[model samples]
Target: MQGLQQFFTNISQFFEFLVVYYSIILGFCALISVLVLGIIMFLRKTVLADRVFAKAASWGLLILCLFCGKLKLIFETKAGWYTLGRWDLLCAHRIVSIIYIVGIFIFAAYFIYRRRRLHKFVKGLDKATTCSFDNEIRKYPGTISPFCIGCIHPIIVIPEKLDVQNALIVIKHEETHIKLGHLWIIAGYDMVRCLLWPNVFLHIAAKYIKRDLEDVCDAVTMQMNGIDPFDYGESLLANAKEIMLSRKNMKCEEGFLFAWDDNYKVLNKRIHRILERNGYDRKVVLAGGILFIMALIASIFGIKCFSYKRNNPLDISGIYSMTKMDTVVQDTEEKIVTGYDGDYIYIDGAALKEAYPDAEIEEQPLFVFVGGYYKIPGVGGGGGWGEFSASDVKDGVFRIENHDDIDVWNWMIMWL
Candidate 1:
């Protein structure tokens, strides 16, 4: 039982490390995405550039999750723990860890419920023969807009009241989504978003990815079918109207829909991109790519730069026979016995003095030496404090160098 307990404890610690690692990476990615988007807007908004930015954000997050373990080790070894101490970093880590674990279960339950609901909804629809794509077409009764459902085996779902021509247009649009495996991307983003629920920036980035995916699908569908951009826009508007008419009955969930009626800005952007003659510019693409690479490099270096090493105080809780080094300032030489008893260090033999009860020994890096302040007991048991330094512990011997007024035979202490 004890061994099993230790095993679980180690597992929990690893997961905590992962939570911290991912949070840092995702937060940095979010800031980068925002800055890139801002620059793109200043230059000019192209569907291609928007798509590239969205892809970068999504794929960057996925890459971070994959390399979380290696990154955690790098952070601990190079960055150090003290660098993160100013922000109550450990408390934030614990909070994020708890939320991450709980969010997984919540999202899992929600996904199962959504799947069951989709199955039940599909059963109530009448299967129709489709001439365009080889997907299963179903007529849905709800006010939800036409959307392609399922990742592996997708189904094109259309509202029952739509005309034959409009239905075909919606079918073509959804089929484009499946052809490009957009559903899989959506699934990946959803999982990452849930896991990093504390990161609002990642959430915004996910929204951008979903929007750009729809725009890309719209552009491809019109170009492939040789359909007039204006006519296609009209079809989207008709679907949006239907969705809005029954908006009160809609249960908003995490899934891909062809038309989101509530988002006028996104709808306008899609229509504008569809109607534009020239698509993505080559120069803009090159610029966006450069910006993305720069951001990635900056994020990596920023993490490394902000980390600092934390020193663990030495555990000097045992007795030792002490001797003071005869320095140029110290004339007397005598052998004294000293011991550290948890909270205080004691000097026994001639010229007895006790440490101020709160003396701390800080171990320097490379195990070179330990140093701290020690107060000597005065008349009526008062405190007279002074700084002290000791050489590295070698062969169970500690050499105290700067003992101030106290002098001993030799300045080396051996563990008793």
Candidate 2:
């Protein structure tokens, strides 16, 4: 439980990181997810035979959404537009962190309860000697028909009744799911739903991704043995009906992937596709796989960076007091009206006007931007000029970092 608590805490921290640094990107992440899912929906049929490609594409999108904030850190373009985390709202961000931590804890408890209950329910499936498939296969007397569960040691649970032919077809369908790695793929979808529960489009995409997984299973199942496509379609409709009726009483929730779904629309599509029984070309599947891979790469090199280059990023246009004074100087109590000439930050309008002599350089508000180095006259913190980026000033206070570095800076500035 403590380890799980730590897991959720880390997740909560990632959540706060996005809110603090990339709030706009956080809002648009959902839209990006929906757009890619739509792309997958369109091209699902062309590459129906290759199950790995579908799963890879789905995982790529999920990873991109979850780690977009981190991407800014990894990529060269750092997050510039921080919506919050100012001195005032920094405290509020901590509060928001606590709130979502509570949310995560509540969901964690609820998921734990469901999992424990599911474990007890699964444990009751007394290995009935109906299907002689394998040792991993567990026979359940429960109403929920055959479904595949687990990533490592995937179990195919066959329920009590069904004709021999239909039963074998059902086993083949689920077996195809296991071999095609659909169980882990569904787990990916569930993670997306669990972490980003607010996104309605993602939940809708889950239904489609799950349907595509089923389609892959169907495509592979027909090729394994000489089962008639019509028979396979009939079995799908029958199993879907059984699962629908069974779901009314007991449904496969939490961890398992139902072999057949009950959605009428998706179910109809699956049945029709099975009737068509089209063949997929190796070159097309290969091309589609490359497309998904390129899309993932594009996300890294393209859409992942949400920040733009800014010469004068920070908007510290108000009066500022010298918060730190390490050197001997006068006028320490004066609040300097800072200004900038484009990217060149300067202070003391009269002093600047005196320096120019020609009066060509006008005094603009000190645009406390990033990466701007300027000679701040009459700054109480130093004797002559202090070489400090305006980025160091938070909430109009220049924080003293590393007293040793300050000593070196003061010595060097005195020479200039």
Candidate 3:
């Protein structure tokens, strides 16, 4: 029970850090992805470049954000330089983190339930060996469009009434998704979505990532099979029509569906790209390349600008008498010792220093760093350091104005 409690405590702390610092990480990712997409779109003639670059930028930024989050967790420090000390912001962070964690649990349950249903459905269906590729192809009875499902052992499913040629194309497309490991990408994205449930920017980025994955699969399928782009577009349109008609009669369950051109606008964009496989002007490419480089540099600068730092340092050492305020009772006193050693300032012995070995310490001239929260007997404990000034000290008595951002008490030196 103690071990489990400790595990949860650690997890809670990590989530708190994420809630405090995620904005900076996500802002950088969003900025970089948007700039990269905009530059690619402007270049115009590079369809392949657009597809490749979009995939890279979207996935790359997400991975980078996850990496940054892990680093923050390991370091136990918020990444942004500025801490928004507003009470409302702190409350919001706590609330949002709670919601996100709950949402992940709910999503996981739903996902597992849906996957079980899908497996049962697959089991009942008649598996056929119609395609040249040795993949499990199952005919689904409903009017749903063809989609590839499952990550580890992917299976292609097609509607029963679809014609032979279109079925082949659908199978080919889904096989392309499976072959290129798009299902795993989508699974990874879903997990990210769950983690960043409150971030609208990340949701938008996810849509773009999904769209690029589909486009890449389409491009690869056409090239590998020597199929006509026009034909593929027609097949997609027919599939979309069938799916729309089917949806009128029944509701589709929520799960991973690698449906080709899930959104109409995205479908249109895919069709346009397929129809126009032209090259861009060299001058435009050159201009875009320069802009891309500039965006990269700007992204780096933005990350550094927002990153957190402990710049303030204070010289604090000695045994002091602490005072605590109470509404009904009188103030209370307790003896505490503070000592500075290397990067960490040990308080009331060295337990904190031992626990958080990599803790960043900064000394502000007038404030004594309490690290995180500290409990003063008969007083209260909060999550920030305490503040005091030179003038606050008189006759060997140092008044600790505010501890952990709370208006509390004073301390007098008892021993060195």
Q: Looking at candidate 1, what is the lDDT of residue 6?
A: 74
Model 2 clash count equals 3
Better of 1 and 2 by TM-score: 2
Candidate 1 backbone collisions, by pair: 79-307, 79-308, 323-410, 334-408, 334-409
lDDT (C-alpha, whole model) for all candidates: 0.51, 0.52, 0.53
**Best-fitting candidate, measured by TM-score?**
2
Error of 2 at 336 (Å): 14
Clashes of each: 5, 3, 9
lDDT of 1 by residue, 145-252 (tens): 887778877887777778888888889999988997788888777776665445465566566666667776776677677778888889988877767656545544
Per-residue error (Å), model 1, residue 181: 1.4
Instruction: Return the TM-score for each candidate structure.
Output: 0.54, 0.58, 0.55
Cα displacement (Å) at residue 95, model 3 = 5.9
TM-score of 1: 0.54
Model 3 TM-score (2 dp): 0.55
Model 2 — which ten-residue stretch has the worst lDDT?
Answer: 371-380
* Ordering by TM-score: 2, 3, 1
